[model samples]
Target chain A: MTIEHSILGVIASRPCTGYDIKTEFEHEGAGMVWGVSFGSVYPKLKSMEEQGLIQNYRTETKGRMKKMYELTPKGWEALHKWLGELPSYPSIKDELLLKLSMWDRGRPEDRQTLIYHMKNRKEQSQELLDYYLQWPQNGHSSISEFGMLGIQYVQERLETELRWIEKAILQLEGEPQPPVQDPYDLIPKQQERRNLAINPPVITVHPESSTDEDRV
Target chain B: MTIEHSILGVIASRPCTGYDIKTEFEHEGAGMVWGVSFGSVYPKLKSMEEQGLIQNYRTETKGRMKKMYELTPKGWEALHKWLGELPSYPSIKDELLLKLSMWDRGRPEDRQTLIYHMKNRKEQSQELLDYYLQWPQNGHSSISEFGMLGIQYVQERLETELRWIEKAILQLEGEPQPPVQDPYDLIPKQQERRNLAINPPVITVHPESSTDEDRV
Candidate 1:
């Protein structure tokens, strides 16, 4: 979906200035799911206004003229139309995964570069995870219950990925194992797979992770 | 990175026709990781040839002309440069998550609509997971060790998400709750968080999942 929908969604909740929208993106859960730049926000806002999806009014806040954008009837109509449609598959594009897929093609020194990158990636996820863990303590103000769900989902995903990266780093550091197994080649029917998916095994975190206490 | 890099990378390994690359995307792990349309592949190939990263020539097979694309030295240089740069964070845009985040704003019936969509999504992932599970039996031919790694990663992620959806469905089905806890708000530093990440919890799939025997 276009950023216009997100912009319209935000305006639907509450009208805000451009800077408010930009800051909301950086610090909010929606921004985590959809990446947008500070530069793209204004151009999109202008275009949204041009399309009559949103309208802006001038406001004086602290001696500065600010343009506040709010959803028009057309914008509300557009958002409802989008919300009625089925969500498409999640669009995932990660350079790290792409680079890792092409691992064998790079030079030996490039391996070192990759390890360094994962280490950095590990650090960032950890930082974010820790910050998310703080939400329970911080008084919930602006976030809706669904927003809280989104935060928890991010925390769980980050926890899983952090562990995956550790395994990947070890695999890269040592001789990678090749897949070897005798044929057991037959996929189950749709109903059977659903039964299997619904009754999944217990979820656990790393033994040493800070959130190990939350392990189920 | 552009699909140009992926095309260049594929051609770097060996020259192939546009149809070959297009088919590779449809059936390969790379395609699952990066979604591209059949329509997109030809236009990208044309632009890459114009930009001098790839060169194409006609070859007649079964009285049909096929344009074969091969990477130029400049293409190799470009691919290497991209590989050298630090990988960026993964870009994710999921309509499901966006719709779910706006759950409070949607009509009550939208909840049922969402669960239906997630069920379809689950079915698709199950189908793909079952397909990947067949890789061991099929004599590994075109896939490298890293490709196998990508497959396993995909399988693991799909497994985790499937379970998450189960909980989410139940949560959606039941009463929605609010957050309430005494504050203990503090984010850890870089070093401590890294140690926590490395020692993450064990991942387990549902008991009913077809891949139960493989769960570790």
Candidate 2:
């Protein structure tokens, strides 16, 4: 539904062919916030046109007939309504965190696998942060100051996440204790595997030792 | 697909009813990472059962029969495969950032609404952080040390976001300039709002205006 509103917003700004809207989403500043794949965009445009929120006309360019879409008054009203509403908190489906929750159940080799993936994530974050820092000056002349600020917000988030991952690696290696201390010392300490954060540690602990804990 | 894998992982740990799986998602540590609504869970369970990844048995309870599900060996193999694969970075669809991107297009009243919402978000973050801090000790005795680590990770993220939003509010109010400096002084200055941050009163004359050049 938000995607529909976003498409309406784009159409309200300017009448364009569906291809133009796709390109705008893929290449324009809007892409930075929400991405609409061509797979979803065409169907959305067709449905919206059928719903009377948008209207289309054919234009001939270089002897090619292209269907251009624009927002009707209804579309304008909808876009305005959406723009005025308070946004909901984004729902996150973080798989890494899910894996982390089950880390204790995994074998030592599985923990090594997890650490390897965390390193990959860290590298990706570094690359994204570097790219964002060097952006706006790199041919993105049309990105407004506000858009740049939004990008900076994302960069800051990435940096924070990278720091958290670094700490998570340390936790996985058993170097840093859990961030919150257990006052009762109920958490049983396991035999530490040799620094998996730096190198693949050997599995010395018996697998049966892990099964002693009751499953949630 | 990730949800299916998550369900598999949960079943692999223990044979339980679909209701148990739903509860594990809603009330357990996994809830902090990924959420699976009851609506999606039952269907996924049925599909996975058809795929032979999981099998279910009926157990007579005090008065009624309860369906319990457990992972097949095939399901165990699939879980291991998923655990080994490099996890993809979580995709965020932050509507607040989207709205911020178009901040200039909004009316003054809309800007106020946005600011109000940011404050609300800050309050929510603070509350969540406080809750995370007090968790595990608050009758969450079954939470493993690894689970506590995940909670701490989420807490740190929320704190970082709160800080970012504070800075964002200041930025939106036109008190602080963009984090990056303008190299060529090409950015046009708007009327300074108020000195929300310290070290103010440096209202230098515009370079082009001082040079008696044409203002675009």
Candidate 3:
């Protein structure tokens, strides 16, 4: 859904109330892959309303107020007909890889902390997969099939990522411990070391092996 | 440092002008795993200047003008502070996954097209890795280390994705042919047939035969 810009595409298929759209979102497997919360949806709907991409009407039904939404003709045209291009592949902005880039700059202990974090994240992904699989498949069968495919796709990819993370951990674990460098012992080639202002070198240490390093 | 945001963080360590910054970005293994263009960088620098995050001075040397850039105190503060936070993990959002998700909606020809696209993408990733390895590794030791790490990571991940693509192609290839359904095949039970619209009809065919019925 995120890949296809399908949320808008799906909504544009017909006029629907907010609840109806939410039902479609959950049942059609879109939610399984491109997650959205009520918090996210309502705001987006309101914004779309403001943009005149969609319109809404309020009605009283069985003593309850219902707000229904519909794509304007322009919005429908924009969704199915316009097809403005977006980047084909999604780019990652992951921070863990950045930490790995700077891992050598830190103490051996600091690097180990990053490894632990990745291990924990991998475990959580597996747990989520298990929970997703346990969902009952008793109703909305077509939607269920679609939802299952999306879930399976995510789970399989996560498993692959775990394999990478495990390999990375192993590599980091096998690396020789970085030797501590003493600022006083290593002098500059031309400039007098004393002439440069040296901030008290705070060494990052392994969170487990060196408790003092974790004071912050 | 797409994953780490480390490229920019490292740059913020000292003030240098745009050209100097570009050199640093290129030398730091950034181009290997991630990319930034003069178009992106110049605009960002201009924005940052407006935001007071960076300051620049024009200096003339050897009859040429050079603009030197340095982080404002705020920029240095922001950089060091962000350094304490862990970098995000990388994620791949392959378009191939999107096409695969809607395989049931596509014609057999579409499936083959998807397979071809995946194969091409896999080959492209591999070729990129190979080209990166041929790049000269001298003078810039840390950046070279980054390049080596990036090559290893990308190559391994691409191999895993390629295996999945191969499996999908094989599965589709081995599908048993279906006894094609006709518009007027038989009189249907109104209730059951109505229910069928809510649930896609399952494909039943010889294990190795191609089937027109829904597979997903």
Best by DockQ: 2
TM-score of 3: 0.58
lDDT of 2 by residue, A17-86 (tens): 8888777765454324556788999999999989988889999999999999866656655655666777
Instruction: Mark the regions of model 1 whose C-alpha exceeds 4 Å error after superposition.
Output: A50-52, A108-110, A176-216, B29-31, B38-40, B50-52, B108-110, B179-216
Sort order, TM-score high to low: 1, 2, 3
Task: Give candidate 2's whole-model lDDT.
Answer: 0.66
TM-score (0 to 1) of chain B, per candidate? 0.72, 0.70, 0.56
- Find the candidate with the highest TM-score and give its number: 1
Sorting all predicted structures by DockQ, with the top scorer first, yields: 2, 1, 3
Task: Give the Å error, residue A111, model 1.
Answer: 3.6
Give the Cα-based TM-score of candidate 1 against the true structure. 0.74
TM-score, per-candidate, Cα-based: 0.74, 0.73, 0.58
- The digit string of per-residue lDDT tens for model 3 on B157-193 reads 5556556656655655565332122133221222233
Candidate 3 lDDT over A1-216, as tens digits, reads 352244454444344676666666564443243435667678778877787767788888899888877556555444433232222543444455555554433322345566676676667656655654554343322322222334455556666766776776776667543222222322121112112212333555754665665557
Candidate 3 segments whose C-alpha is farther than 4 A from its true place: A1-4, A8-87, A104-109, A128-153, A171-216, B1-7, B10-16, B19-64, B70-77, B86-93, B103-109, B131-141, B144-151, B173-216
Measured with C-alpha atoms, the lDDT of residue A138 in candidate 3 is: 32
Better of 1 and 2 by TM-score: 1
Native contacts retained per candidate? 0.35, 0.30, 0.12
